[model samples]
Target: PAVVNKIAAGEVIERPASVIKELLENSLDALSTRIDVDIEEGGTELIRIADDGEGIPADELPLAVTSHATSKLRQADDLFCVQTMGFRGEALASISEVSHFKIRSRTAEDHVGSELAVTCGERSDIRPIGCAPGTQIEIRQLFCNTPVRRKFLKRASTEFGYISEQFTRIALACPRMQLSLTHNGKSVHRLPATNELTERLTLFYGSQTVEQLIPIEAEHGGVRLWGYVGHPSLNKSTRKSQYLFLNGRYIQDRSLQHALNEAYRGLLMTGRHPVAFLFLEMPSDQIDVNVHPTKSEVRFRDQQFLFRLLLSTLRTKFLQSD
Candidate 1:
């Protein structure tokens, strides 16, 4: 249905940062070692992302922005066993629906790459362009066609904060990927590829915050969680610093949050929130990521069991000084 495209677009590209997140994921999936993001006015006016990765092929250029055209997975079974960060392939199509979009992609084999432009899901131009051996996408006037969605956006500074936070999490997950962020031509963050996870954390959270982080690892009952958690003394005044990734996929689960809160019950003062970057790995079939449109929330078959395990492990780590 024609309406389904618009609905899919709404799910894939909710806001500027949501667009930014999907594009960044594509760059990472492309095996890009370096990604540079440049934004103007919190990515509402303009957002440019450049990545030095294996670019899209010439023949695949048109399909890149077509609805449901994805190279991430092939069959329905793949959906039940997704290992990559993004698989729906709806990102580009959705992005094109709300903004002025342009993509310049060149694989290493192709002598020249193609450039395509679309405004509100309508293609205006598609031609060959001489570019480097990589992909560079530029999005402008996000949600300009959808005035209602545009109104939901926050202030530029606030939106930029969310964009920056998402970038930080993605970078943390792929420590080997070098990521840089610039706003209005001024560099806000520049992180070169580093093998050390601590360095990446320090670059994002500052040395003091990084110093307060503790490594976390727990495995039992076909589930494994690993990452860093903040010391009780390093609790934040808000829950913004908490990150939970299920099966290498970033997710927001209230049950997991409750488990964390339970673990910190005796250690943290009231109104304090603990900072964490925990990743839970399990069989993909056991967790349903499609439960949410944005793919930020998940449904676990045994959510209670997962919650209790998280709570017990976190509490034991502190009690036993593990």
Candidate 2:
């Protein structure tokens, strides 16, 4: 069973950045309002995520890392409408299999916290501990048991770059969450809670980019679209500036990319892409997220409808400005 976990861990635990992404999703799923991340040696040495959210019970600490065990889903039908960020339930188990993992949590009603450690799939008894009313998880020696994976890892600087990109996505997606990042004992980013998305936009893209952004929002056929689409003059040479999210979850879909391109085809010059931070909120039943292990890709039931809706939204906005 342990060997099976190690093999399966490879599917989701790709690298240090992968660990960061999964852990952040768990924190968000817990309804965390404030999250702090600390990384060392590009997260291969240590990755710590602390969140002020509802914590787990003392007894459930062990079940938290159990394979295929999750609180988000009760039946097979629950997979169709997963609203939480970490639903697969295999993430924590997968992460623990490849790394030295420990989770300490304390609920508001509990007088003391509970701490549990699972190192390389070896479970340790839950112990009583003292902590604040929240949860904190730490990962150390990631991929240490898998020498091949460790060898394939890039340099610390390059790995941290990937982690930074992941951080940027989560921070942007939840701008209202108080988020902070620290690398190698140095503070990299500290974003305060805010109601406006422009603050985060300016922080990430600069004042010039924010000033040129035009608000775009509307609802059609039960799908709500909101976010900023850059002016044609504010185009970029690459799609790196195009950030798309569905129901608050980041996704990479070719159909949506095509819709974006079709919307800006004549507006942008060849090889140029428009900057957009667009989000689509639709009924969870309308999409299927089980297509990927990491849930980064989704399949829409009526994809053409989404494609046309996106294209029309941008094209109409552009036409209005003209």
Best by lDDT: 2
- Give the Å error, residue 160, model 1: 1.4
Candidate 1: tens digits of C-alpha lDDT, residues 58-137: 88888999877788754432443324456477889888877899999999999998899988888866799999999999
Candidate 1 wrong stretches, greater than 4 Å: 1-8, 74-83
| Window of ten residues with lowest summed lDDT in model 1 | 75-84
Candidate 1 clashes: the total is 0
Model 2 — which ten-residue stretch has the worst lDDT?
A: 74-83
Regions more than 4 Å wrong, model 2: 74-83
